[model samples]
Target: MKFKTAFAAAAALTLATAANAQVGPEVGATVYGPEGNTVGTIEAMQDGVVVVNTGTYTAPVPANAFGEGPEGPIVSVTKDQLNAMMAEQEKQMIAARDAALIENATVLTADGVEIGTVTSIDGDNAIVTLEDGPVSLMRDQFATNETGALIVLATKDQLMAALNGGSVEGGEAMEADAE
Candidate 1:
């Protein structure tokens, strides 16, 4: 029993140490533009991409696009260049979403269970009206099925929770009917 306990404790410590070593860019770190001008601060990292929030706009720069300067992380593009790139990306995304006809598209789970239809799209979120209520699904949480329908990467129970005012990860309850 003593040997087993010691092994378990050592394993736990090793796992914790490994986890702490996977550090990324720190939040609140200063970000510099290509022209070496201060543009924004790091907000967060999402899927290996660094999100920087400038005073006017938030941009996502790929991890590879950043370099360690004397001060901190710096991008190889000026603020105007970053804005232009973001605008182009947004345009392409909007075009793709429009092509998918996400608005009013049937929403289904991975198991082919139908939950609701997308009523509208607002920014990066799609407003879905389930039988119970309305919920907001982020665009990234959905994919285009082979039949051109919108498939939510979640379970029916998860979708229902968002509709019923229960918190769903990466989703929001837009409006719940009072009963």
Candidate 2:
């Protein structure tokens, strides 16, 4: 697989405490860098990862990458560094996604569950034929995982819910379109 490492290495031991002090960074809590500079705020916790909102972008760091500090939870990368890394990662991810998005290709969820088949591609949109029917989705929504498997950055249930709720732009449930 040609996937670049998706995770930042675990934060330095000095910055992280055991198990983030038996808990993890709470949402809205400020995250610090090793030098005690503000990196960002914890926006969410999902699947053992913490989403740190750096204003410019959100970076997904493993929960274990955080350590308790005198002021708050600390991560290894400074604000600027993390933001730059995230930007680079985003470019790489988009490139990988474009490479994998071929007609007839099977798309998988981030956790590796096959979600649908790519029936066609039009400009920046793709039509994936799910169980119900075809749904149009933006190409930006697709990316490859650490194993280079073509996947979206959501769980199967989340994608299904979005399709069912008609929340994804240009995505209409196949059955709903018939009605």
TM-score leader: 2
The alpha-carbon deviation from the true structure for residue 9 of candidate 2, after best TM-score superposition, in angstroms, is 36
Q: TM-score of the candidate numbered 2?
A: 0.61
Please give the lDDT score for candidate 2: 0.81
What 10-residue stretch in candidate 1 is worst by lDDT? 170-179
TM-score of each: 0.55, 0.61
Instruction: Output the lDDT of residue 81, model 2.
Output: 97
Give the residue spans of candidate 1 off by over 4 A.
Answer: 1-24, 102-105, 109-155, 167-171, 176-179
Best by lDDT: 2
Tens digits of per-residue lDDT for model 1, 10-42 = 999999888655544578998887778986889
Backbone N/Cα/C clashes per model = 0, 2
Query: What C-alpha lDDT, on a 0 to 100 scale, does residue 87 get in candidate 2?
Result: 91
